[model samples]
Target: MTLLAVQVLMWIVVGAAATGFASWLAHRSYRRFLRKSRGPVSKSLGRGDVPTKLDTLIDPLEAQFPCQSGLATLLDNADAFAARALSAAQAGRSLDLMYYIWRTDVTGWLLLDALVAAADRGVRVRLLLDDVNVQGFDPAFLALTQHPQIEVRLFNPTRNRGHVVRRTFEMLLGLARFNRRMHGKLWIADGRLAIIGGRNIADTYFATLDADTRNSVDADMLLVGPKVDAVAALFDSYWNLGLSMPILALWPGFKLNRTAFRHRLARHVGSAPSRHYLARTLDSRTPEAVLAGRLHWTDKVQLLADPPDKAYGNHSAAWMSTAIADILTNAQSEVRLITPYFVPGQAGISGLTALAARGVKISLLTNALAATDMLLVYGAYRRYRGALLAAGGSIHEFSPLPKNGRKRDMLHSKVFVIDGRQAIVGSLNFDLRSAFTNTELGLLFEHPTLVADITGMIDALSAPDQAYTVSRPDHALQWTVARPGLPKLMYVEPEASKLQRAISWLVGLLPIQAYL
Candidate 1:
């Protein structure tokens, strides 16, 4: 054989060996991470325990405001923030909070301080946060876990732990595992009062809480009565399950001293900005009224939650979306949907089309291209805009922040109202991710009063000032937008820049529809 041929063969063999070794190393690392799983533990709410601390504060309030069954009050974005703070402060026994994103911003610190105070006062606090958004907030979480009464866990956490660089590499290697996420948002205080819906712990979500209108519009339900217990049960199921792991266990480098951690948190809480925000929150008198059981309640509320295994591609555990689909399918008169991301896959499109064909007045409200935070999701959703509009349904896209507001505002609400009598409010967005790859939670209310309230809110949001009507006129798509107390204007369907439209077009060409 020729010397050149032998040299070429040798180089090819060396390249193959290196590739095989690298693949093996990645697989080995993944297995090592999986081996740390501790399986499920038998933790529960410790039912029937005598409550000396909680009863002292809650019992009298319950007596003062009694409900026939479950009572639910619709809390707009700002009011919901006040309610959560109040619940944490008034808690005697426990506080359980689970959310998809708990940003380490002003709002996050304010709530964290409240929880820490509750824990310091002997109130057991359990926080279950999703692993996807915890990249930059590792120190905050590690410090939080140092408190004796506070326990922190991340649901389906990344094996790379808090490091964003390593987590990105792991995601590239483990696409399937990284794709699924925990999308539920919940807050349960004293195991007696619960708040469930779309608001996460972020400055953007609670923009109105600090009298800041520069955030997204979200909704949550303040629930009491027997339903709180059911929501607690859902929390337990995720907390004790094998998929969740303690933050300390996942990140071995988190060795901050407990005393120093507490002091640091206290110092930050006592800072000027935090103290000012706290004073304002307290001055609102909203907390006082909430603790006194002044919220209006309803009689019937059905809790819908997706199991943690939904992140493992388990379709059966996607109960929130399933229930929502069933509700739309059974609608008699009208179906109104308000969601931030609306990527109606073939099944969703068909279902809604069938509903519209049955003479049901179907209306959809979602984010416009200029207002959406996710471009790929908007790309997938825009493909169906014409089809849905052609099927005798109305589609309203939220406008970007008006020049009068502080910053750009987006529509982050997930709501469904049917027949003016039944409504759903929760964290289940009408997108493929929420339907197939994320755990979600929501409440179905059949009370006429609450449904009417939601219906009215929907009417207000659907006004021309808040959203633009997307219509296909003269064989082309156009958007009609109206500013607050101003004349209406028209534009193209996307209302996006040329480069953005080009990127969106490229994303649309990919064959990952189910995942998008």
Candidate 2:
């Protein structure tokens, strides 16, 4: 071999050896961490006795709302914050929360403070969060769990707890196991009142303070009565699953001093921003009305949630997608959908075409390239737009500069309104990830009032200036861009950067379509 060739071969061998050693070290560290932290422990939430005060509080609201059996109230934007915080504060027995993302932002700490108060009042609080979003916030959660009545668990936890190098290594090495996330979001109190929908517990989801704090436009449902019980049962199932690891179990050395911990949390909550939230939440009338004998409730609602082991397989039996499919198939007249990430792979395209063929008027509203948070997802979604439009589907993409002229916000709400009779709302998105990877939950109901309310919201959102309608004029792709007042301007699919378009094109060539 030549001298230069020998040197190049030597470098390749060295690089391979380094890579192999790194992988071996990662595997070894993960195994040791798991071995040290392994344990079997306590029972799940919702098994405790119902509180007397809980019954007393519900009686008056029950009489006022008069929901015969099942009911839900739409909690939009800031009101969602009230629904969640108030539910926790007013709980007399149990408080259970499960979310995919629980950030340590202003909104997050405020809710944490409320849970602390609930725990102080002897309301048993159980918090279950997906581990992906809680990487650096473990110490805060661990401190909160110091309260004797509170327990925090992480679903599908990373084996490398606090070590950054090991964490990244395991995540890269164990992609399949780590990729399937728990996307369901729920907040239930006293097994009587609940809030379930797309809103994660963060300032961005609430957007009460200012436009800068608003990351996306979203919605949640504040539900009371029989529906809450079903939600609690779902929480229990996941809480007891083998995949959930308690906070203390994950880091046993983190000692819990209840008094000191509460004090520190109190100080954190007393910060200026937190105080503002506290004042806003306390003064909010929506929460007062919700807790105090108000809110019209209907009795025609059904809860649908994916099993905790959904990533194992996808079929007609266990996934929320099955339920959603059934709803769409049953729609005879019209179907309207709103999702941030709209990658409806082959099955979705085929199903929608079939529905359109059956004379079902379908309207799809999603985030435009400029309005989407995930460029890769947007690219995946863009590839199917032509096919869907050809199938007689009307597509509207939200504009970055919406009619209400705030900071650019992404579309995060996931809603399915079918036949103007059923409204399905929750954390399930239209992309392949939500369909086949993450666990999802939603409420499907046949209440005319609720359906009309949600449908009206969709109508307003798809109106002239709020979104850009994608049309195929003369069998060519065109965007009817709506400015404030002038006639709609035509462009060749505006609102996306050239770089973004290129990235989308490249993404479409990848073999990860099923996992987008």
Candidate 3:
């Protein structure tokens, strides 16, 4: 009897210990989430500066919906419009443009020529871009800074103008305090219309049939109405506050006048054309108003944003993920996701697993080895092959190198479509870094025809013969299968290479994955 009493006591003690450990772990996890959630972001501008009329601009967004009066999708050539947009600024009463990176490729030239023309015509042009990404920018292109009407600035330009070693260490040690990019890709024209979305200023994004061989698709939106002013204002604030070179500072010998040029350029811009500018514009406000316009949305959707943390009362990443979760949680049928980077941590996998367990079709389309720019990210991504495949999620890898002669292109579009009802394609990546680290943007469209169009475009991209898929049997020993392919297409361990790849890989291995 005494032995029995002791056994019961021991069991009770064990249960308490287990509960304590569980409680401790639960508390730790909760703390971790809180750290990530960080309190709501403060507004960029104080309440005194808040535009009371900004809400009035939202009416244009409504016109974009098919039913509600918002934009459907601009099936136009993004590059051509990009050319027009840059040129339109030459006629600028005022032009504000911002981007993460502006490569000096053919696409860059098209954009640059337009801007220079605008400056020559006398427009007030503000150009803001990420200095880190533009490290190797062409010197000739950099010379364009000498123009009078334009104010060119870097988001966080580094002082180490000499060696790769110093610049790299600066990036690594976090010495580049402002290294965090202004990820917002925006173009505001005369404060009347704007273009915002996932495409940075580059050629791969425009994907012309002539220039694009692989035929990877990307999307952006042209917004008209009151919302544009707010976007324009955001561009202005960042531009005015960002880094600048006082002309003579960068080029003491070339510049003769600053004020005269500014005055003269302003006059020229006034003489440029506005009626000739062309781009798609989206808007519609009330549900009733949408019907009156003969516009119809594929689904009832809400436009949510990070807003200036304090003003919008949400983090950009959380708001975006919640939208994804809402789609996943409420999905009655299938979930189709098209993201360039398919790196999802534990929570993402679990959410996908839950949906798959309930007999829903879950599928993903992302970049293959040859199709990505960040190979290490793909290296990190390859680690989850087993879990994702085990969850009954079928995957397809896109090959940037098309069967045709088109130069291979990384599949850079970010798209999320739920049950064929609604879809989003914009600047947001599925990775955690994009969520918490960068200020991202994208448009969510609700028209079924638009959804179908996006889905169809994805299907065409996936139709290529050589896509990587994770089979259930393969998932059984998937880790082994995923291992061998690393060195072939990825930069897993290392083989010394030229500066670019080597640096990218070393940067990839740093402990600061959260900051990437």
Note the Cα lDDT for every prediction shown: 0.77, 0.79, 0.55
In angstroms, give how far residue 287 of model 1 lies from its true place. 4.3
Per-residue lDDT over 119-160 for candidate 3, one digit per residue giving the tens place of the 0 to 100 score = 676655666676667666624334666665665565545544
TM-scores for the candidates: 0.88, 0.88, 0.64
Instruction: Superpose all Cα atoms of candidate 1 onto the true structure and report the RMSD in Å to 1 decimal.
Output: 4.1
Poorly placed runs, candidate 3 (over 4 Å): 1-92, 138-148, 162-166, 175-179, 208-216, 233-237, 240-328, 400-404, 464-468, 474-516
Clashes of 3: 35
The C-alpha RMSD of each candidate to the native structure, in angstroms, is 4.1, 3.8, 13.2
Candidate 2 matches the true fold with a TM-score of 0.88
Q: If both were scored by lDDT, which would come out higher, candidate 1 or candidate 3? A: 1
lDDT for each residue of candidate 1 in 1-516, tens digit (9 for 90 to 100): 999999999999998897667657876776666556543363435535667444565566567656633445545555667788877877777889999999877768889989999998988889999888886788889889878888898887777754668777767666777778888999988887788888989878865334444578788888767677789889998887666788887767668887876787778777776777667656666544655454555566789888777766666824778878887888998999999888878899999999999999889999887788888888788677787888889988886545454666788989999888888999988888788888899998887777877778777777876778888766567777665554355555445687777777777677666686
